[model samples]
Target chain A: MKIRKINPAGQREPPAERPIKRRATKIHYGMSEIVITIVLVILALVIIIPLVVPLLFSFKTQLEFAYHPWALPKAIRWTNFIEAWKAVRIDQGLLNTLVVCFGSIICTIPPAILAGYVFARYKSRVTEILFYAILIGYFVPVQMVLVPLYRMEVSLKMNDTLYGLFLPMAAFGIPFWTLIFRSFFKSIPREMAESASIDGAGHWRTFFSIMLPLARPATVLAIIQVFMGAWNDYLLSLILLSDQNKFTMQLRVASFLNSYGTDRMPRYAAAVIISALPTLILYLIGHRWIIKGMLSGAIKE
Target chain B: MNVFKRKAVLRTEPAKRKKKDPGRKVFVFLCVLPAILFLAVFLYYPIEETFRLSTMKTTGLSNEVFVGTDNYEKLFRDEEFLAGLRHVFSWAFWSIIIQLPLSFFIAFSLTYYSNKLTKPLQAIFYLPNVLPSAITAMLGKFVFAPNYGLIVSLGKALGWKWLASIDFLGNPDLAFWSVFAVATWAYSGFYVIYLMSRIEQIPKDLREAAELDGASMWCYARKIVLPELNYPLRILAILCTVGSLKLFDLPNMMTMGGPGNATVTLGITLYRHGFINWNYGKAAAIGVVIFVLSLVFTILQFSLGRKEDETI
Candidate 1:
């Protein structure tokens, strides 16, 4: 990779320029900058309000909710969280959700990394076709396979099982993540693997020892992303896992809210918060990684 | 891409390694085989099955008779499905025009201007994208609760008397747009996160140099950053288009495609035919069409985007 020097005009290419150069570090704050800052604040509020409103409402009593959703709760209530847990059987839902999230991650990541390495390193005609064959799956909408997926699940007697829920999700994810890992692997120089081979390391040794450790960033990005995705899944869970015991966090929360609208407004809000908690905490912790990963699959290496 | 390098490597390889080549090929096959097998069974075969099943009238995934293209023929004339297509286009229209630019601005605001609040602001904006669409849809119900939503309650509280409870989901006229608003809130942050991250990867020195050279933020964003973000933007557009076509969780869970099928999308329509009515043939037909539409649309967007890049 060659680094292109920024020409005198501050563009990547060497080009004719017109701007007058001034010293760096003294940023002039103008009216538009202030306006954009306000706009940014407003936009942040637009997002924060909806998310935070539920957190506030989760503590509001019925009368308070009816009277003033805008005002603060007089007292913080842990009972609302407990009630939300019971309303949705959120404990079970959480367990099921975690199982699906991690189970799918378990089922998906190892294969993606392995295949991605092979696809990137060992180029051949068959693998080339195989690579594109899997890549094609990325574009096929899930709805296209819905009817058959259900039929297949039923025939396999995997319906109403957690495995049924996550396995297909895993299968669907394999192609996209494989594509991501493939690109990530491609970016690493072949010389590393070649040198390792020349030192009498087998292909597996080179992959596991050298290449795999080097791919930690992509791996973390994929795990967090795939975890979030599995966490948010509803359409598949709704179709396959019909039993209440088998319900995912999404299904439970949605059903709870539907069953008892805002009648128990606080409880409903509590349920919303509880369901949103994991991803929120995850985002707050690993947002930098999440954002990078979100773009990882989209950007060309 | 490197013609001489590839030839040189090939020429330098020893014949003695041929003994190990067969084993290495086998190792490579073993590595990639899982992904190939999974996609074949789960995606490609199901796609082929969908096409086959679409041409057959079936009940309960069994007891079927061949009915060549009848399902598709009926789909073309089916009023509700056509309405669903119209709804999809409208959804795509709003998503591309409104959601795309709003995300761009949010990303632009976060990236172009350096501030202490940038990370936290970006984090908050990105939260909606991480939340399940189901949860967001439920929130939409709460937001437009008519009887209890702030719009009505606050109207009552302040004694301003005329904020008539707008039936956002109940009214046939407003269901689509109401859902669109929810979709915007839920999905706009998604693109912004990607755009912001992608934009941040733009060399900071280039930006600093431009700024010091008296190039305003707007001019830098327009002339330099936009071109750099060309690939991601193109992807976001395709995603928005395909996403609109396959939309399910929010509208379906919230409205059940009602206000009398007024907000029905292709996805909801497929769900209705397959799961609700057990009209597998028709459902599969819808599926086939949806798949083809996404494929065609994706290819079209990719080509158009490539053309734009060439011009750039």
Candidate 2:
């Protein structure tokens, strides 16, 4: 049976005694918080300025932005929305992005959970060797795999297909996601599994009926992380599928920039705002959860 | 009554004596089979292929020749490749020089002085981290739009012709820094969020204690907070290092490594030689080098992570 380490705050064997010399060092932390805060605010402005500037400009006319680049728009260029939409065909790109995201989520998450559970519970030399081998997969840069993968897809006649992109993306996301899931699963109390076993549940029954339900938080996190990754991806889509019709939103949006015309800037403006919307919405809903997950992982380590 | 107890005890013996089930073991293996198989095919196979192709030559006409070590030799001597290496280091230098400690400062500000006003301010700062890189790149393009661009308008009016006279994207000397600035703009928020998350993990007692002791803010930060954040700071450094080396998209979009390859990174080089130039052999060599570089750095990162884990 695995033993759980008592957390630092929970250790109560002895009264917390302070060393005299260390007390002086403790005095420095509060003043530091102020300094840290000031530094953070200034840095935030530096980052925010560039991001906010273009967004502010998106609402202005070309003439307005050129002449008063830093000023607020005279009035919102509401027309730019429809114009960017038509110019970039953002609706179609969003549709494609959605399809790719859901498709890969379906492909990626369940297997990761099942695999993570077994690795965490089964505990054997073979499993240990296999888990390390899976990690080696993350070492190969995405760029190196592009050509051979493209060749492999073409030969298999899966080129220019959504399935083509979906499978590879799912495959690539597995290694890192699996690592996260495995570590998380390992942290769950085995007593929970023991109780399920005592109830006469078999491995499969315990996994599907009890363990999967309990692992929902991590699973949701995995889904969102993979969704974000698949959404932002440009290189894989650019290389794998040649047909413009098959383009993911990222590729489509980027291509809009190169579209030859005097109206390119407005189109560019629309494409960027449109492409960022789903992510923004996702962030609004899932922001707190994602941040919580990251902090728990980072700090606990 | 004695016979009944004996019969019960006898029945329990068989249940206890039942052999370990090979069937159950196989079932467990099957459960993990899909993940293992996928990694082998998608990941393990391609890595092997890169190493294999590095030794072979692919002519445009479809001939493959075995030319061992010649590719690596050629790379060392290739002026263009050397220039690309220089660009990557310089890119990394400028980015880390500005962005790393800058993130620490932002994180400190957002956490320390954060009120209703600054809380929203922090969120606004992190907005870029959520947006897709493609959008960030496009936004950068909007701001850098030559004569009518934001920087240009501000510059010429202020009599800063050097900024106006030099084409930001077209000039070799300025191209790299311009790209660096935009990349910094896009990513500094991400690092801030990362580091800030770590800083928040620190306990509240330490903060209260420091405040009561009349410790100046700078001393508290330098002594207490920065030490605790040291691990994240290290990880961020390694991530930025690898990122700068393999930087593909920003330079591609902004300069196309233009003004004659002044801004080309190893990633750009591999893409150009392999995809655009169709010199598959040379591209494979570049890929191999990149693969090795990525592997080495990843190992370094994990080792550092492991060391921190041990200390804690």
DockQ of each: 0.53, 0.36
Best by DockQ: 1
lDDT (Cα, tens digit) per residue for candidate 2, span B1-312: 999999999997776345225545775688778887776666677667677777878785347799998888898998778878888777777677888977787777677665775656656666676677677777676667677565765686687997766567767887887888788877787777777777877898898787656566677789889998887887888788788778888777666777698889888888887778877777778888877887888888888878766433
Off by over 4 Å in 1: A1-28, A68-82, B1-14, B203-215, B301-312
TM-score of chain A of each: 0.84, 0.77
TM-score of chain B of 1: 0.87
Residue-level lDDT of model 2, residues A1-301, one tens digit each, is: 0011354565444333334434655655456655655655565676556544556657777777656656767886777777777767767777888899998998788777877887788878888888887777767788777666765677788778888888888888787777777877788898998788677787778888888898998887777777777887877787777787888887777777656332345445555677667777777787776555544443433
For candidate 2, what is the TM-score?
0.86
What interface RMSD, in Å and to 1 decimal, does model 2 have?
2.9
Model 1 / residue B156 / CA error / Å: 2.4
Task: Give the B-chain TM-score of model 2.
Answer: 0.89
Q: After superposition, which runs of candidate 2 have C-alpha atoms over 4 Å from their true positions? A: A1-46, A49-83, A260-267, A293-301, B1-20, B60-62, B156-163, B310-312
Give each candidate's interface RMSD in Å. 2.2, 2.9
Model 2 Cα displacement at B40 (Å)? 2.6
Clashes of each: 0, 13
